[model samples]
Target: MAENLATASYNRRHDLLQRLRTDGRLDVSAIAEEVGISRETLRRDLRKLESQGLLRRSYGVAYPVESGAYESELSARVDSNVEEKMRIATAAISHLGAAQNVFIDEGFTTQLIAQHLPESEHFTVITPSLPIAALHWA
Candidate 1:
């Protein structure tokens, strides 16, 4: 039951994020009108999204993070390939093998892959993208 609730909350947040991608802002009344949720509910959802690092909000504004605020250049590139990046990230993780030092390109997509890396699967990654490095450490 808890998992289901989490999933529902996640779905709501994901949908809201996608909307922000296209619209640049999440108006409470508009969100209620479009999503069929009450403004209060949408406000709660937005608050959760803000806390989760999915977005930043103030007063009545929300914008997709850009450049350094988002993924690194490598992560951005990898995100572009979607399936291929996923496959590569998944496969490359197997090569980690307790290695302490790593290198990554200055690409956002590549850096995004590193962000998702497991904490227990320890490795030090060297990357050209500051965002990726921050993501790894974050």
Candidate 2:
């Protein structure tokens, strides 16, 4: 009996993912209604899918990465560097004052520098170890 219940749950989760593809996006209430399950149950199913990185829950909407065309679009935007980070750093450095403090928040590009910074390009560096604070040298 437990096995049958588990199988039914697995089937329900599978069906929910497929339905999201056709539907573009869904909310827990709507999915619950469509699948004839409780809202809590649908929420649980969506959570499992999210843990697998197969779906994203934003705001009140659950969207399938491929079906909604957002996953690939976001990846494309992030893939191309366009030298934005380098350009910004250059522009920031152009303004010259003897002593000034600047900070860039923790993010992907800055984290790389934190791990390994070039010895040649010099500046009065000020960072709260923008990647991982603990790794900062004393």
Candidate 3:
């Protein structure tokens, strides 16, 4: 019975990870219902995934971590927590003082920050990305 339970646990966690990978994120209540597991059981699965560095969980959501080298390619990362990235970028803008020098990186999140920065705020923008530099023309 113990072995069976362990196998069942493994299968459930595997399925949960597969779901997260496909959707980029998972809703706890929805996954628990779909997996036919109790919320407590699903939470345990999420915790195990967290320890594996396969995902980051917060409240009712689980975000997948692409394995190795932070996985380059904007197309690969854009779908991952897009809303969260936007929120983070917007929050970062709040920290900038007006007319301060800001160095934006080339990552997708930084790109979002560059795009979303309010026109009312002025800054000396420094970026290595051609796309961001092109913003000067827009």
Best by lDDT: 3
Model 3, residue 94: what's the lDDT?
84
What is the alpha-carbon lDDT of model 3 when measured against the actual structure? 0.83
Clashes of each: 17, 0, 0
**lDDT (CA) per prediction:** 0.71, 0.62, 0.83
lDDT string, candidate 1, 1-138, tens digits: 999988777678778887888888777676788898887877888888777677777766676653333332342354466877677777877777777887877654465568667888677778777777677475
Give the per-residue lDDT of model 3 (tens digit) for 57-97.
Answer: 98799999877522336766788899999999989988886
How accurate locally is residue 134 in candidate 1, as Cα lDDT from 0 to 100? 78
Q: Local error of candidate 1 at 41, Å? A: 1.6
* Stretches > 4 Å off in candidate 1: 66-138
User: Clashes in model 2: which pairs?
Assistant: none
Clashes of 3: 0
Which scores better on lDDT, 1 or 3? 3
Worst 10 residues of 2 by lDDT: 68-77
CA lDDT for candidate 2: 0.62
lDDT of 3 at 24: 92
Estimate TM-scores for all models.
Answer: 0.46, 0.45, 0.48
Q: Lowest-scoring 10 consecutive residues by lDDT in candidate 1? A: 67-76
The regions of model 2 sitting more than 4 angstroms off are 67-138
